[model samples]
Target: MARIKPQALLNQSKKKKGPSRISISTIVVCNLVVAVVVLSLVTTYRHWSQRSRNTLETQSQSHRFEDTNAASEQKSYDLPGYADINTSKGLITVELFKDASPEAVDRFLDLCQKDHFKGMPFHRVIKNYLVQAGHSQSSIPVEEWTSKGKLRGRLNTSPKHEAFMLGTPKTKGNNNKDFELLITTAPIPDLNDQLIVFGRVLKGEDVVQEIEEVDTDEHYQPKSQIGIISVILKREL
Candidate 1:
């Protein structure tokens, strides 16, 4: 056979087949699939991790509160009961935490059952912050003590004073004042150590908000009369 020229060989090599468009397309699709899988896995992991963290935080706050008077338990317990507070503005329902603070809950229930809180003014009204009642005196007069329920021994205080939580300010001594009630409209971490949290608002959040919006004077007393008309204790959820 006759020898081929170098230029001719080069031209033949140039004419050879390259990779097909279908193969390149296949490679691109595979890469996209792998990328999508990795992204999905990362997103799922992050979402689950966030949920776990939130649950742990909530448990820690609600269950792990250690107090000088009470011992905090990591385990769970059943809630006590519920109540309806009939205020001048509207009806407010609350969930009792007898297991958490028995003395406070019992005292509160006793007072409500006896209609002791009837016509007692919300003495301290801090707009958008808190609403306090059951003080020694107010524009509206409170009845005599029907039950002298005072806190004794291990007082299981709340870890946090979350919004809508019903609690009492600490007294001069180690125990909380019997009738110095407080209902927070916003998170009050500062009062966490100063109050004994025993219940939370179940319904009547609108009433709570309305109470928070009530006009107050220089001393935090409401301009218009806002008081607890009555309170009814029930065993409902």
Candidate 2:
């Protein structure tokens, strides 16, 4: 071969170096592109996973809502019936728990059906606490007894004064045997066994509290007689 000049040889070396540099740059660019693709895939996967989890959670919440609504509907359908006792002081509405306490509810319903609560004074009133009422002595025997003669005969048949006493039971343990109403606030002793709470005052708690606040005599009877004008039961919800 003919001898090449040093400058020509240097130029040839530079030309070779340029291709190597271009190759290295190309390799670097390819590696960077692959890294970016991998990063993009990872980000997409993470986002999709998060979205799926959120969607599942939302679906679960929707199911729970449906279940809760169904339960509420069932409860509304099954709720016990209520009665309104229109008192001189105010109105008292009670939801009868016949399933929880049958005898108690039956006795109360019997009296209410008879309209026995007309013009009966609340016998005992305790401030912020309770009231005991339903006495045969409030009105004349004729007026005291409800128009329905069924309960009158039952009560009149009893020789004992306690038997006819409203809220007082002939039997010692059963409070509901008679119409002896006890205003319930604090926990009463032996209440579950000794007495059955047949009714609850839904609206006249303020009236009960007012009655309770009034002064009582030595017998704990309210100074002012809080009378119940009438107590009626409505079957409609």
In terms of TM-score, which candidate is strongest?
Answer: 1
Maximum-lDDT candidate: 1
**Over the stretch 128-154, how does candidate 1's per-residue lDDT look in tens digits?**
567888647432222111111333123
- What TM-scores do the predictions have? 0.55, 0.48
**RMSD in angstroms, all models?**
19.6, 14.4
Residue 61 of model 1, lDDT score = 78
Q: Model 2: residues >4 Å from true position, as ranges?
A: 1-80, 136-177
Name the weakest run of 10 consecutive residues (lDDT summed) in model 1.
139-148
**lDDT values for all models:** 0.72, 0.59
TM-score of 2: 0.48
* 119 Cα displacement, candidate 1 (Å): 0.9
Over 22-133, each residue of candidate 2 has an lDDT whose tens digit, in order, gives: 5788889999999999999999999999999999999999999999999977764554467776777777666665555556667777776777667777776544334667
lDDT of 1 at 202: 81
Residue pairs with colliding backbones in model 1 are 69-154, 69-155
Model 1 spans with C-alpha error above 4 angstroms:
1-80, 137-159, 172-178
